[model samples]
Target: MGDWYSAEYPSSSLHSLQGYRVFISIAMILGDGLYNFVKVLGRTIFGLYNQIRDKNSRSVLPVGGRTSSPTDSLSYDDQRRTQLFLKDQIPIWVATVGYITIAIISTATLPHVFPPLKWYYIVVIYIFAPILAFCNAYGCGLTDFSLASTYGTLAIFDFKTGYMTLASPRSMFVSQIIGTTMGCVISPCVFWLFYKAFHDLGVPGSQYSAPYALVFRNMAILGVEGLSSLPKNCLTLCYVFFVGAVVINGIRDIVGKKWARFIPLPMAMAIPFYIGAYFTIDMCIGSLILFIWEKIDKAKADAFGPAVASGLICGDGIWTLPSSILALAGVNPPICLKFLSRKTNARVDAFLAS
Candidate 1:
């Protein structure tokens, strides 16, 4: 056994270094870094599209009978062309180059590596990403789309506050960081508990409400129940709150001309609720169908497993990514959705059917 001790293995005696462990760590770092790139890249492209459309519409307006100033015409053409090139081509080019660079650097550096450029990449995103987005929004000429200021809010929130705020710069980057980090930390523990419970109880997606019902049922047994029995319209309260946030933020953005003040708080509250509810409903409905299928035929369930599993890709498709990123930047979900529908509702419907 002492002969097994080799200089190749970093572990000397009892703490034997495992090649598998080292490989796994390297894989994880690469995966995480790529994930970060995808998140930023998707948002950047979405905003770029918004800007191009804005510019296109303005260009179509007749140069009018009014004599155009040489400087004004030149300025408009330059801005318009830049918007088109940025959206139609540039982002993908930059992303491809960036990814290639990362892969090459990581491969060359290997185990004893330094990922020093992570912050540099983030700073580039924080600075130019929003500026690009704002240009897109401005060129698009959508009165409601406020990417510039909102992107600014996101940058400030990410670099400064790390997105802890509830109202300002809704900071989806911050939320995503929190969610992914939490998911990483908690997924294993949750998975273990869920697996054990699921195996024993044979709980299915249709039975999601069962968990909530079970909790309340247990509470009632101990007479510990309080507001659960209340008939008050909780959803209605939520609706009211939603409207208030939307209107106030709109007023702030438009009338008050205070984009910073209005955009952050209301958007922070509104976005997650809206988009979260959308995906939550989709998951719940999908889960119910899976449970029903399981009851109908176990063999079909086995065969259909991959189909159901594939549903997750839809959740992360081109559509959902942009929607989330814009929301975090304090841009409203509906506006972004309308501006760029991505995979389309029909595709989403098909995914669910599968």
Candidate 2:
């Protein structure tokens, strides 16, 4: 099933996701994506039709030139004007359009650098990444739990915004640009050093397995080819999920939010498919810690819960840098403890006794 797009790459070079669950997730993504595409297409066609119809029906105005508001943008429920040093802040619409422009350019040009990631695939990611990022950001704001990719999982704090705690978007944008500039220079140097040390990727028993690269590569392969290129029944599952997404949304609309409150979000529903069994345990433990803290002292938890959570997340990430250095030095933890399944534990015990 590997590399159905071309015969040049053997099975070893282009690894296909043959595992049942992983294959299903691929199907789900494909199916849901197709549904979204259809919806967008329909809406675009309808909008164009309305514009043509409106132009044909509307009467010509006199020289007096009296009309309604020129702008038809949706009004926000909470409209609060923000200022930076007595000047009005840049509008959200301006930022959004600017983002789209930059993203389009990046999508169009990125394939020149990474051939596996075709322009169309990049386009699709650009279209949906914002929605996914919004879901992750909103969920993090509510629960302090980030779901999805590493970037998605980041619960960035703004001192001004407070929980988010909110920062000025313009300032955030400027800071991000600076950070990205640094990362652009730093990341390649770090990777080159790792490459020099490791020699090659996908080395068996190598400390740096680079699973993220493998996952993205598989995605790119599927995107370049098609769902049919994947393992058998995956395409069928993709079809099922696509229809299922539409039907589920229809049901939610009919039932209404009060009744549909129990229904998990599309993003939340994907967690089981994407996450491992052990991740659920970690989530539960984290939830329990916060719950207990809140119960013990409501005031302190309200004030310090976010700070503590932020510290824990930052600490874990910062620890990795030192850990990687230690690992490269061939230093292992003195006591390496692990939890194993009952069957695996029994086998290890039996072997040790033998």
Give the whole-model CA lDDT for all candidates, comma-separated. Answer: 0.42, 0.59
lDDT of 1 by residue, 1-354 (tens): 124333443321111222222222223222322333455678899989988987766665567686775546554534454444333332556656875676556555543454644545554554555444433333222112222321111221121122112222224344656877877878797557555544443342332223423323433432444433222343244345545644554465465554554353443332223223454455556657777888999777756554454555345455745754554455644533322246567787788899
By lDDT, the best candidate is 2
Model 2 TM-score is 0.60
| Best-fitting candidate, scored by TM-score | 2
| Root mean square deviation (Cα) for candidate 2 | 9.2
CA RMSD per model (angstroms): 25.7, 9.2
Question: How well does candidate 1 score on lDDT at residue 268?
Answer: 31
lDDT for model 1, please. Answer: 0.42
Candidates in order, TM-scores: namely 0.20, 0.60
lDDT of 2: 0.59
